[model samples]
Target: MAHWNFSLLFGSAVLWAMLIPCRAFPTGAPASACENMLPVHTGVQPQPTRAPYEFLLSSPSFLNGQPINIQILGPAYKGLLLEARSFGSNAALGIWKTPPNNTKFLQCSGNPHGAVTHSNTNLKTRQTTYTWLPPNSGCPPVVMFIATVAQSREIYWTNVKSKVIWKNPKATCGAQMLTRTWPAAALLSSMLLILLVYL
Candidate 1:
């Protein structure tokens, strides 16, 4: 009986240890983990200049070519345009605007404009959400998001900038993918082997 209990306890400990890392590192882990790997942007004021329209923008401080989540909050406007552009050259990369216009002004990086993957707007609360996939190749170290609003025939704009950290998908995602699955696989195999031996 004591030997059986000891085996069970050992198996339980192994199972518990495997679960800790998965919970600690979630699928959408923050970029803070790679902060030291990227260049530090210092001596620049952190706060963005306020625009005529009241708004709030939420985005990660560091990007690793993952789909970026962008949220905008402000008063309801007649029209809203969100754009992603190269940091210094003002070259467009992607755009999301109301009315679905495909004019020359909407072109991205001299290429034809492409629509945003997902977009949602709540007029009552005046909030908007957008998902953007930045180009993996030839992308700059930093990118800017420009949110423009047209309210009552007047235009208001806000800018939010993010740092881009290049991560080889094969390396980063592959390792994380293994990390997420390896523990579960090992746990199952260990539990089955233990059962076969003990029973």
Candidate 2:
């Protein structure tokens, strides 16, 4: 009976010794497992939260040589800085002649919609407008803009995306290309699914 007890105790000690390393190494959590299997998440940081100060624009797309207005019509954002930028073919509207002061216009052509106050509370409603005069004709029929917000105290830059809808309204610019949605939708859905799985 004494020999049998010693053998059982030795076995228990070995089992615990093996488990101790797993618990102490901290390498088996789901996150660690994912990190081991996948590349590091590398991309731009997320835009700050707009909360009540949402972007309002005239159209969802833009056309060459056409004038479009961008309105920041919403509540004030506390502890936040707003920035507007144009990318793709229509990028010229904002970054063309002269880029706005980085400190002031948020890189837009003219004035920024707002300088929201950051707070634990909700954002205030505010409004501003930016008119984009499209470049010469034959530019991409559709472009995009990124309106970003920076958290005052932190290094977080939150952004809201706007589709610079291009249209000749009068159809004088030539045959226009219709915007497609399937590709964007598919990409977004896939990302959401991955996020859900991780969560």
Question: For model 1, how does the per-residue alpha-carbon lDDT over 1-199 read when each residue is reduced to its tens digit?
Answer: 9999999999999998876543321111123312111111222222244654533434443244556566545565443445566545545563333322211123334444432211222232344455666664555545556544433222333242333434343322222222344688899998999999998
lDDT of each: 0.43, 0.41
For residues 51-151, could you state the per-residue lDDT of candidate 2 as single tens digits?
34455777665555545665555444322333223343212232222222222222223323212112232333344344555554444445554443432
* TM-score against truth, every candidate: 0.41, 0.37
Clash pairs, model 1 backbone? none
lDDT score for candidate 1 against the true structure: 0.43
How many residue pairs clash in all the candidates, one count each? 0, 27
Off by over 4 Å in 1: 1-49, 52-65, 94-106, 113-126, 158-199
